[model samples]
Target: MHGRLAKSFKMFVLVALCMSLTLGVLSGLAMAQEKKVIRCFVQAYTPRERMEADRWDPPQYYWKLEQEYEKLHPDIDIQFLKPIVGEYEAWFVTQMTGGTAPEILWRQLGAAKADYVKDWYLDFTPYLEKPNPYVEGNDYWKDIFIPAVSESAVAPDGKTYVLGVDIVGVGIYYNKNMFAEAGVTIPSTWKEFMDIQEKIESAGCTPTSFPLGGAMSNPGSWSVRLLQDMMLDSKMMEIKTGVKGAKGVVKRTREQGGSISWMELVRAIKLGIYSAKDPQWQEQWKLLKEWSRYWQKGFLAAEDTDAYRLYITGKAGMLYDGSWQVKPTEVDSLREFDFGLFNFPKVTEESSPYATGIECPSIGGAGCAAGNFCVPLVVKERGLADETIDWLMFVTAPQNLIPLCNDLGSFAPALKVTEGVDPRLLPFIKQLERGSERIQPDLSILTPQYYQQHYRILQQYIGGRLTMDEATDKLQREMEKGADTLIDQHPEWGLKK
Candidate 1:
């Protein structure tokens, strides 16, 4: 009787242990399903903006992220809200400032960041101080990202607000067929670059094409590409290298280090004339009327889209564009034409590197969040802030860089990667890797008023409205006036002239 009772007791104990294990499994699954969600908002893309839902469709770049986020946490959702056509800034101001905030919102960290950082954004130090138990040490917070990314996101009080997922700037895109046809070895100096354009035109084809608008064409894109010229000639780019938000008005390469004063460059600016009637060239300017006379008939009337089609059609020899010009592999002409790329030619020495013509990334205004992100201080107050931080680190992980670059169809930033990127990009990337680097901005980031003033002055100079002396004086005066306002508003920006 005693043996039987002992055996029965042992069986009961085993049954109880099995039931406990099964319940534990069910509980774990339940917890997995209980993950959190963050709603995000962004401004419309320029391509999308230009088309305004007429012909172009929204890109599915964020689709992959949405799916991945959902998979990781069954309970979490990332519903992206894109602002209306041309009303992005207006809508964001209305909705965000109106107290209808997104859980995990993002925007450019420009002048607005300086304004928003005080009250608009969150402080991530609490989450960053310690590692999440589920994940390994927070290497991304400590050291993985490029210093520039960290600088834009970090506050003076030691809080991390936003992480730059990528860098956006324009570079010169060329045609391999055109290069071969011209019999010109890849030009290293600014003169060589121009000579190629002249050769292409001489061969009865356009040397290059770009988009220009308003009363005139603005060469901001051109300037940023050649900024490295100033970087190599000057110490500015090197000084600000890897450091975010460094006060930079102008940086020149060693060859350019005061070689061509702003005044000198202004004088030479008229020398590189583009023809406005060559609508074949989107960025065609009227200041160079003689250059306009050189183009073939019917070239002046072409719109930006038409010009792009012509280049892709291979009728035009070379196109001066950015990664944006290269559509996906599905686009027939883009796939067919093997495009070559070079840094925009420098203003002075060919050997001297190019400095991009654009400036001041991370400004908080304009409302377009694509290629940029901003985290409001409101999100930090939530319990799920940890997850929000995780999302950023994951999004910026080097693994995602290739996919993002492939989607964007331009050059990728100089981040450490496992394998190689697109071959067409290899040459440009190699140059950037070896030489000095600077981040240039596209039109979306620039202050329209400021840009207009600069444009009018440049137009006047090129059109002979302002002499070189007058142009320099205007630039200096404007810079000083603007500098005082900028300095007073954000002393941290180091905008002192």
Candidate 2:
């Protein structure tokens, strides 16, 4: 009887042990299932404080999307990693080459698309044709975006690799109180513009804030547009449209249509249709020199943020920045006075190429694809491509996007929002919508070496280190060298005659 009882106890212990092992194995499997993680590398879209606050409350746009996505797929997690603004390009490139790149990446400004699109980014053209599960009905995801937005991201190879979220327009932001106190109106011509600068300066405030300390400085592009607007004429327009010749002589075939192309700019350079030696070109340099005097003291040494701070604090009368400034200047920063926006004034016909006055706001320094994103090829290699693309589509839907646009205040949505935008941004939006006869591409789009040389000489010229003649000569050399390189790189562009 004792032997039988001992055998029964041993059997019971074995059964309990078996049950414990089974439970432990099941728990391990469940935890493994929950550990899925998706990584993203993006630029800072909202203020730092907002991101911190989001940890506790209902999340902001990015955070909200992340949280909702995680909730829907409880087994997966999303991580957004933001690199330092100045180091982002280098960091992204390194990560990509190392095969550790994040699944999603914000496209860097001035990054050569040809350099990475083929190897690093996944072509979304196939996915874009299909319907987005997040959007209503069976509408193609690409169809919802403004046509220009999608068109801007198309590569030379005709594949759409990047997606832009916002449209940015560059302009001047002015302190209304300073203008009123100085008795100056928004100038409509170059002469009046300079005169107002003097008046604002005489009133004991800096006329404007122009930062020249770095390659990414705002003044470099803004001033370039100003020069282009001042110097645009029939001859210039003709060359931009692929017509080439000396001063009064011009030539074009029916094959050379009226539209502007980068090739046209290159051909003009090669043929000397547009030359730094032109009298008008010299006049542009003179205008730049005169304009430099109105910039806040030490502007050449000051950072872009420093210039912005001076403007908002009333120490500067006008701020030359993009529509993106609206949020930071009006919403985030402290300001003692009302502010308004106005375009760079038109140059007189004597200074312009066209008999009709130049457009008030030049449109083309930056455009619809300012905030673009792309999925890295690594995402597909790692088997996360579908998940990553789906999340991007979800975040860009109207319901998700409109709130973020309201928060940003500076950019117009690439997607058409049936819901109204923030009322405060409408004025700036209207300014951007107004057309111009000529819109020059941002000079930064030039080859890096050329853009660097151009801006470096510009900084020297503006800082009194180089004379107008010296600056123009250096610029011409750099422009020719850049054109040569581009022609060699893309012979199909037909930049050469």
Candidate 3:
């Protein structure tokens, strides 16, 4: 009987060992599966409110990214969590400070500029030289992407924390068909542009159309478009620094660049950039008045989409929108009419060799680091971060860009003619290339403290808070205090020497 009991005990031990091994294998597999799935909070871009579709899903653009990437990487499944959209600064402070931030996520650019505009996000420096395997060292991208684009996306310290996925070049859109209707030619200089605007207005059509609701066409965007044209020839910023006609670029009223401030507008380019009694101060104010007079009575209150609708439906003659504005219309009635374009004409005697572009295209109508996704250095996983980088390279590959353009008529990659693109857009892209393609940063680029102050200055200029002189002078003081280092890091730009 004792021998029989011993045999049973041995059998029990064997069975228990087998079960333990089985459970161990299963647990390992489960952990591996968990690791393979990447959970990222794509801080919601296509606001649920703004979606052009009836569905509650994320934008087709994000789905399009996931579908293609999954085909290449079948082993990994990406789950995108959508964060609610609200005031980015407040939300970021709550989420990040609250310690519930996503493991993998896009840094809110507006919030980043407002709060943590520093090195905390993520650095893709080591990744760029060894960019995504599919597009590492792609010659087309290297050539097609202008240096200024990198200038805008990268901090002066040489780290890429953001990207401009779709570039915005604010050019003049005159209907060749409309010019034919009006019997006027496209202007070549700022002077000629004013004359053209006057003529277009005289013809009883809206000369230029834009909107300034909450923050759309405020002082920064409006000022830069004109400033981009002005800084090309003679600059008045030198008056602040005691220098001559300013050279190179200057942000925040040019005085930051050692360029004179409060100086008289050069007489030569009076038509394009200097129409007021004072070019430095009154120029912007005068232009705003001119813009106000040229637009419809209720234009200042129009939504951006409404503004575009006005232009597309033949109600407005000239529309000054960035490149994204030129696109496939959602409404069928608006898509038929063909629009023509020209870069805003030079305001100086000699047009800038490098004409700056006003590029802040929508990533769902608010600030998104659209073309940018940062991978923190501390992600520490060997292959996961690379996987994300590789995927980014795949989607933004110049070849892949054709589908994005065709799928939604959304963005025009700065290429002449990639396969499957509508030939009609080729000339427009070429014209954008001809225009100075510098990336123009908005007030967000300055210290967060300056946002209200800057807006106030613009309001003062527009709503008469300060005369142009008072506004410009006030701007110089605020800029010197806020963004001197950030702007000065790139010297030879006409800032304090």
Report the Cα lDDT for residue 203, model 2. Answer: 89
Residue-level lDDT of model 3, residues 1-497, one tens digit each, is 99999999999999999999999999988866764555565442332334575322333465666777788887767676666567755764565555454445565333443333443455655655553455545544434454434433445445566544443334566566666666778877655667766887787777766665455563236445455334432342342233455465434321111122111222122222322233443444455554456666565466577767777777777776654544533333554566677655555433333324332211111123233344543344334666665665676676665555444443454333366765544444444333331223434434556656666566556654477777767866665545454445434444441
- The numbered model that scores best in lDDT is 2
Flag the better candidate by lDDT, 1 or 3. Answer: 3
Ranking by TM-score: 2, 3, 1
* Cα-based lDDT at residue 80, candidate 3: 69
lDDT of each: 0.47, 0.68, 0.50
lDDT per residue (tens digit) for residues 1-497 in model 1: 99999999999999999999999999988886665667666442222233543333345555686677578767776676665556555765665576567765555544344454446666655654544333345443434433344444544445555544444434455678777887776765555666776888787777655433344342333443243333323333223342323344443221111222222222222222111111211121222332333333454334456556666767666555445554432254344667755555444433223323332121111111244556665665666666676776555555554565555554443344426555544443343222222322323212345445655665455445666567656755554444345446555554443
lDDT of 1: 0.47
Name model 2 segments beyond 4 Å from true.
1-36, 46-59, 109-112, 116-118, 245-259, 350-356, 360-370, 435-445, 493-497
lDDT of 2 at 153: 58
Compare candidates 2 and 3 on lDDT and give the better one: 2
Backbone atom clashes (below 3 Å) for every candidate = 46, 4, 15
- Each prediction's TM-score versus the true structure: 0.64, 0.84, 0.67
lDDT digits (tens) for residues 1-497 of candidate 2: 99999999999999999999999999988887666678776464532344552322222467777788888877777887754567666877787789987777777322534554448778888988989887888478888775545545556566666777666666788989999999999987877889999999898888998887866576666676556544655466556655544243222211111134557767777877666666665665667777888998888888878888888888899888877677777654468889988777777755444434645544432223335677878888788888888888887787777676666566667665545777665554455344432333444434778877877887898788988788888888888888888799777885563
Itemize residue pairs with steric clashes in candidate 2: 232-353, 233-353, 233-354, 234-353
TM-score of 1: 0.64
